[model samples]
Target: MMFEKIANKIGKYTVLLISLLIALILYPALEQYKIGHICLTLWSLITMVAIVVSLNENKKTSKRIQLASGVLFLLIGTLLTRQVLGLSQEFLYHLILPFSFLFIAYIIWIILSSIFKRKSLGADELSGAIVSYLLLGIMWGLLYSYIEFISLNSFSFAAAHDIQAKGSALFYYSFVTLTTLGYGDILPISRFARMAAYLEAVTGVMYTAILVAGLVGHVGRHR
Candidate 1:
């Protein structure tokens, strides 16, 4: 009962935490402060925990899976903080990106399962849909970052910033592209980058369609 209560609390707050992350991504000016990276890292950890807690409420996913995801997220957060603080980078920080993306993808699966397992859509289910969309964008952003890192000039940002700021730039660009909002400030130059952008754009459209269809079907069936 205590665990259920905790899960419920986390589920209720999922939307608020996600909104904060989106706010930070949209307003990069807040990231200029030294504390900005810390905020982002901490927020990421909490979000991961909240997601796992909410998923556990369904009892469909195993405890081992949840624990693994939580540990992976915690590790990524720790590595991110260390990288930001210049504490450690010997183990290759970029390598962690792929794992983080995988973890996010798994989280999306859990959220989707939870959403469809219900007979009727509630506020939590709707919020989970939004979170899944956001996670998709974030996952693609990590892919873009990895591509750019491996191949120079893969993507270009209009705003001039240091190499360290590329992560934020790619994230902003990914969301813009995901929403099909071509701001033209960031351009994908390489073939891989262009392909990724195109794929994500299509995926976004398809995801919207699928989510709406699923929700409508569920509502109709229940009604």
Candidate 2:
């Protein structure tokens, strides 16, 4: 009974989480089109709506909604400034970084709150847990991009073509690091970049261990 109640409470997030996963997965292909940034902006708006709807039960719901609105507005404004006004892409990236960090932080907080409040596992709970892990990889990818923007040559790419260590490349690197796969296709040379990579690797291992242990315990109790 308790598990069902908790699961129902968090079930609202399932659709949103699935949407986020789809968006991330499609992002690389979307980049091939000229309207890719616009599509990404639209996805952000959709995700924001999902977040607001899912968190309607929270105490600061109004504030979170407003925050999401602000993020959308800023993202749109940034996109227009870059595309329409012919601003520097570098400047636009810098402007968007802080708000991006804030938005991702808010998401992580919400997911962690939902996960920790659960006394038992359910399908929704397991899905949320997995999404949270993916979110960590996305967050680190953004951080890696920011670092690359600030300090060029932080990472080396082993691709045949000359690839910039930003965007999908860094995102791929982030997930690889998070999983501790160490494919060696992308190498972090700078001190800070190396530090961030190792930290993500450690976090990935620890988080998986803890999640597995918790799931096992829950199963044992249920049995």
Candidate 3:
């Protein structure tokens, strides 16, 4: 009974938690292996599925299943093109980044709608808020990767690393910038890159402040 209750309580959060864990721990740990990119691709697909499932929680069962199926189809196509097709990484990035941006935008809209709705905060709403913040970091990381792909040497790494700005490195940089950490190990050198870095930093600060204020106001009204 206790296990069942715990499972029910965390059911809504399971996918989100798994996505976070894969990105933060699993991906990073396996990144040095030959299967790293494969894992990364799988991670992205899983994240997309999680977002679709979360957004469709209120829809009819049939409609939810249909939407999830569509998303899965699209993600599978992307994965095949990346892995099976003899396409350059740059070409793959060009193809995927636009769709990735669209997916992130849609989920952010849905999550923010849930967060700002005039209702008592619940586990769903709280998780949506947290996921939305992480999504922002991911969105910025994608942008950073895109910028670096188009223009080499856009970001300078202080450490003597053979790989340029890409993959997990850019994500780490994004979160660091988002938190305004400015670690200086990775520095954006180009004009646009600098602008993006600072913009993310500002957005991070503003988002935290606004989210806290909104949650507090909601709590006060409920009381």
Candidate 4:
């Protein structure tokens, strides 16, 4: 029982840790250190573990399904780490990375849905919701990365750097699009890229409004 409680805490705080990792990766001081690879590897591993742990905590899910999700995440994490370590070729990024993000995004969606269905709002619910928001940005960021990787001209940046040259810029553009900021520093040129940007913008606004209202209603009922 005690061990399970500890695992639950880890699952609850996973998003906060992930957010910190993102900041660490983006920090200019660490740019010279090439921390992106290590940080991203760790981030992916932790996300897998967190999702598995959360699945274990939920009584509604069957043991078999939980075990399957764990196994799937494990396989994806292995591939992701290998790619990050340079043991795998660029082809892995073209294939494995996008699939990995898609899988994790699905897991995050499940976790968020479960949290939202809870009868009362707690720290876990609030944190999980925020994590879901961040995960949306991450998912879209990976998609943009893939788009830029496949076609150098998919997006235009003011600095005119390739996606590999300034990897963080893709993530920056992701959040900018998510919040509908449209800074114009980076513009999506491809039809699909523009469509994705618009979709993210709409989803971001709706998610924020719905989550805020739901949390407020939960709190009010308890009060």
Candidate 5:
């Protein structure tokens, strides 16, 4: 049982860590990008295998956490590919908003998960539940950001440069998107991209809502 628990956490975190590094390698939007992309893909597959083994142990909290993280990680993995390519504002102009929202949401999710763990009731079960809830937020935030960024860049990079963007633009856009607050300075120029952005907004709202609901449920019912 203890061995299983340790493996489960290792698997989940491996997925998260590899995905983050892969994003960095892939977001440059430049040529000669194949190596990083392939390595990221391989790591993603390995993470999946680890998650599967961990889940097979079938502990309830582990199952739920793994399930949620697995699904989110898959999406996040796909999105991480974009991080390999978001290189210049010429390219970023198209993907700026999506990338921005994606990064911010991820940061929020990680921080929340960490805090949730720290607030434990001196019990493993409660702490795990809160951490799972937090991962749900993190997973959604990261997954949504990846989708948003790819959609924008793939569809709009050809419209020509609107000026170069710094790497920080992704974080800025991600924060706005994660908070569901859009200022309209950054617009999605294509139908799919627009819808992707909308979905991100919805996802953010739902994640926050779930976190609040989980907190309430834990307090009222778990106690």
Candidate 6:
């Protein structure tokens, strides 16, 4: 049983490490190639599926099935702003693939929170985990959006078309909103885009208030 658990941890971390390496190094290097793009897509799909599967429980499978909803949430979130703004299929190809990878990374964070919850959490751990999760979500969202913007930005755009850069400027924009350090340089181009920005900002506020408070509450009431 010990060996089984250790092996599982190793497998999970190995995939995560590879995902990070590819996202940070390999993808950036070979980003312009068709084969590189295909490899990235395959790597992301594999990583996402592996993460969803990692929630496996020996006794009950349904509890783990909830993990699949993580994948669903990612697809919905990406497709919402993506399709609403009517991005090109070629751009969608690059955007959805990398965004999917980052979303899985976010779900992995959710899994970490679940693990922390199962262990003993003091007020410090509670505060740290809540802040970390919020920061992580915003960070991952930015990365995925940056890739989108990189693929979309063009020189021959009109003023309206130029605003597409703002949509793709997700990494820079999301953080500014999350930290409430709005620079106002990159504005939301469309209603769907504005809605996403609003949701992210609201998420930033509620995350601190709700998750942080819940952690403190649990710690305060502990036996």
Query: Best candidate per lDDT, number?
Result: 1
* Ranking of predictions according to lDDT: 1, 2, 3, 4, 6, 5
For each candidate, the alpha-carbon lDDT, in order, equals: 0.75, 0.74, 0.71, 0.69, 0.48, 0.51
Tens-place lDDT per residue, model 5, 127-185, is 43333433333444444345444554522332343222322243345456657787655
Return the top candidate by TM-score.
Answer: 1
Weakest ten-residue segment in model 1 by summed lDDT? 11-20
Q: Is 2 or 5 the stronger prediction by lDDT?
A: 2
What are the TM-scores, per candidate, against the unseen true structure? Answer: 0.84, 0.82, 0.81, 0.77, 0.43, 0.51
- Candidate 1 residues 131-169, lDDT tens each? 788788889988888887778788888877665588778
By summed lDDT, the worst window of 10 consecutive residues in model 2 runs over: 159-168
Model 3 misplaced stretches (Cα beyond 4 Å): 1-8, 57-76, 80-87, 160-165
> Which order, best to worst by TM-score?
1, 2, 3, 4, 6, 5
The alpha-carbon deviation from the true structure for residue 145 of candidate 3, after best TM-score superposition, in angstroms, is 0.1
lDDT of 2 by residue, 1-223 (tens): 4333543676755776677788888888876554776677677766666666566667785587567667656766677557545565666677675567667767777876766666776777777777778888888888888888888888888763222326678989999999999999999999999998999999999989988887787777766
Query: On TM-score, who's better, 4 or 6?
Result: 4
C-alpha RMSD of candidate 6: 8.3
| Model 6: per-residue Cα lDDT over 1-223, one tens digit each | 4433643555444444444445545644444554554565455555445444554543354354455545554654554444445544444445554554455455545654563455356443443354355445545455435444554442112244333343334544666677667677666655555665677678678766876577666656664
Candidate 5 least-lDDT 10 residues: 158-167
Cα lDDT tens digits, model 4, 112-220, are 6777567776666666777778778878888888888787788888896744555568778988988988899988999988988898899889989988897787777
Q: Give candidate 4 misplaced runs (Cα > 4 Å).
A: 1-36, 59-88, 219-223
Residue 120, candidate 6: Cα error in Å is 1.2
